[model samples]
Target: MARIKPQALLLQSKKKKAPSGVSVPTIIVYILIVAVMVFSLFSTYKYWSRRSILQTQDGISNRKFIERKKSDIPNYALISTSKGQITVELYKDGSPDIVNEFIDFSQKGHFKGMQFTRVVKNFVIQGSKIENSEATEDWTSRGKHYSQLNTSLKHEAFMLGTSKATHEGGGFDLFITTAPIPDLNDKINIFGRVIKGEDVVQEIEEVDTDDHYRPKTPVQINEVTLKHKT
Candidate 1:
């Protein structure tokens, strides 16, 4: 009931006042922290999403290649060479575009006078376009095409492969292996194999070659005839 001094009353009133609201700087800092957390989460989600898409695409491409290898086609090629007549079973299903192009060129007599450019004993024999050859088609305009190297097909003995094309123009080059080459299994596009004339392939392999594997005696592909199962 005693009369309170004015200064004492004022001090008591200040002490009883409610605490002020959070400062503007503190609120702004909290908002910035939340924004940073949201951005981090969004960026993480996008990185994983892109990775998943690439994985799915790779799986699809591999599956399609396997399916094509399982398919069958009734086609063959008889390459009459200076050494002998070598018969091959074309893998049109595995490498349809390359096989078809080879068949078309053979039918059009494009390989009439081409010769085996390179040969390595117990390795491979490669065919290339030679100057002044009897190829009637104008090969200058022909650009490089996909070799379709990835497939179930392998580089076994007597297997035929199409070398990867080059910028200087080399889609039609043929490679015939004389032995199983595990190194080139997934690297070369194998499209056929020797169904006949195993001895002929061996004979070609025995031919003398220079240090660079170029045939000393130019082995010629006299003719290439495409056939179908009757």
Candidate 2:
């Protein structure tokens, strides 16, 4: 038998030995892969969480809702405008938050001089505050921002709804539907319906508007008078 050289034996042994530790590049790649997975999971959870919250507000998710007493809430709101008075029967039991918020804003004269900025022929008549150059409109100025959503509430004809610009919570904007907007039932907060003055709403809807649906002859809300239950 030929004796193996010591140098060759040493080289062979070195080759047989396993690596001391993983390479820095391999470890870095593993870490990056794990981080990506974690971030993806977190993003998914966040999206579902927000969606669930909205569902809960809509009374579709598994959450209990405490209702407020009708006596404590306003019964009706008389929206006096340039055209005529629009009497809205408040949905005190259905959307207390929105009803109360509307009362607060109206009593404060927030919509006193506001204009009906948008009008869709057969859709909706939207009103928003006319902000002065020195003042910027901020929905947060109101107490608590609410995105009132209830399955029972619907966007029927002449239904008074919560502001559409509620992404930043809520706003003083109000919209009256000209026709049944079933699509908006789950999207917007329906707080009241026209108890009277459907003709006035029709009259406003008939006004000539610009390309953007703005009333050529400016229409404004002179006052909003709340009528509480006796």
lDDT against the true structure, per candidate, is: 0.74, 0.75
lDDT tens per residue, model 2, 158-207: 88996544433245788898776656665468899998999999999889
**Which lDDT value does model 1 have at 145?**
14
State, as a TM-score between 0 and 1, how close model 2 is to the true structure. Answer: 0.57
List candidate 2 stretches off by more than 4 Å: 1-70, 130-155, 167-170
Regions of candidate 1 where Cα sits further than 4 Å from its true position: 1-74, 130-154, 167-171
Q: Write the per-residue lDDT of candidate 1 for residues 113-207, one digit (tens) a residue.
A: 78887666556777878432423232211101112233333446788987664414433778888766656655467889888999998888788
